[model samples]
Target: MQKRVKYFLIRLHYLTVNSNHERLHQDREIIYGKRGLRQYWEITTDKETISDDSTWLVMTKIPKINYKKVGKIYQIRAWVEYGFKQSKSELCWADFRVTNYAQIEKWWQLVMSAYLMVSLHSDSFNPMVTPVSEKFQQHDWWNERKGWKNILNNLRLIIKPYLSFNIISRWLKVFPIPQLSLGLPRLINLMNEFDCLRYFVYFWDNFYYSSA
Candidate 1:
């Protein structure tokens, strides 16, 4: 019976998610378990694609609701999974190796913060800039779907000098003037390469001239 249902679904025309001709079958069943008898809504898609040759079958203990609502909820879940994949793959969300609880928590917070910043500036990181170069633009992160990591790396390189200065001054009460001199030039060159010097200079000038 299950095999017949599967074959019928695969043979149906317009088996995609957007198909209006698709059908949903819902029934209540007492699923046996070690705890006790549990009732669930066994929602099966008559023409929804699960794989190349199969349809989807979902079981939920939630109260009876519209099938379209269930589908919408599933779609949202898919998007959430996509976000987790992005965080893990592009933001290095799982790259830490700390065993201490506090350190692990702090690392996760930093990673999440960096991910948020990169996502907020995703438009600026586009690889489809005009006057494309064969050598440089070809390897652009946006072009290769690796924009998040590239943005994080670029921001880190540009801000390393200031961050280093802050950390050193916090610990030693004195600024490392020698390191500043060596770092600022390289930082400026990097900003120029990333085409962010104008914005950087603008912000610097504003902060310098602003009355606190």
Candidate 2:
């Protein structure tokens, strides 16, 4: 039996959506503009079910694009949103206090630079990269990880040594006398005595593994 839709004077009847990205319905409406005329699509997509939040309404000015394109656009939007959130939280991107448009633009450029830096490291660490990270790929824990935030974390770790060096060199006016503290060799001897070097790991151990 063929499905039926009942249209009334004031409203359109509900559509039975059956699959994701399936175009439940689409129509164009007049959008008057400076160019004299424009058209837009009022689109609905199926989310694979009728009872759930299974239908989505999408409005786009591009009337030529199909429902699948609309779905991909939204998916891309989700990825963009995720990247923006990462910029804010991980890359120290912040709201601009300067009201000048030029300053705002400069801040945007700096933020984008930081974002690109993190993205480079993140891409390198991604298991799905064209050339996999062969060193850690075999570890079960490495592949089953949750998010790329760890890449930013490892980056922070990498910068920490330089930061410590900078602070100690420039800011420390009083230095610890070599006689007062155990030297690195003595410390290593103590470590060997306690047998703790293998267990006590570097910051990258948290970034990836104890060694690599």
Candidate 3:
């Protein structure tokens, strides 16, 4: 009973849907500016550094709370991806949760290694591209927009991917791609692209292709 209550409270705190009529302007301000893409930092939680220092460019995209029970701890990785001719350095923050901080650090190290390893090829590692605005515009329901804002507003909070298999299968019906042959590792990499969905679209298309 206690566990159930705890779970309910956590879920409520995590996914509460609030009416924005009073805060419409405020929500709009949050949705379109630096306030829209909120970022936060914490010194420690459960003996872990919950957020990176401000000296670096830090961003986190968390999933949902309910999904965490399945061992899908939300993750974020921060590292220096580019360098400039100045004393200050540039860093990128990515959200992806693992069960423990060890995995978090490992993933962060992987990206750092990738950045350094790829530096031999180019001065920058540009493996991922931000989805085009047109893609988002097509799915522009008010709630969808609100959800996007929620993601941006709590970028640092840990969350499990909010999507489900049924949700994914439905999206697959829309695309007519013949096949996607991505092996497991590439699939994981694709999932890392977005905190939610975590490459949900990519997963659907690839899975659709694989089935074909």
The most accurate candidate by lDDT is 1
- What clash pairs does model 2 have? none
Model 1 C-alpha RMSD to native: 12.7
Of the two candidates 1 and 3, the one with more favorable TM-score, higher being better, is 1
lDDT of 2 by residue, 26-51 (tens): 32232333222233323333323423
Q: Please name the candidate that would achieve the greatest TM-score relative to the true structure.
A: 2
- Per-residue CA lDDT of model 1 for 118-141, tens digit only, reads 554455542222232344344333
Which ten contiguous residues of candidate 1 have the minimum total lDDT? Answer: 4-13
The C-alpha lDDT values of all candidates are 0.48, 0.45, 0.30
**Residue pairs in collision within model 1:** none
Tell me the tens digit of each residue's lDDT in model 3 across 3-92: 211111111112112444221010001112232234322211222332433212223344322222211122222222222211012214
Which stretch of 10 consecutive residues in model 3 shows the poorest summed lDDT?
A: 22-31
Ranking by TM-score: 2, 1, 3
In candidate 1 the C-alpha lDDT for residue 4 amounts to 18
RMSD of each: 12.7, 13.9, 22.4
Ranking of all candidate structures by their lDDT, best first: 1, 2, 3
Between candidates 1 and 3, the lDDT winner: 1
RMSD versus native structure for model 3: 22.4
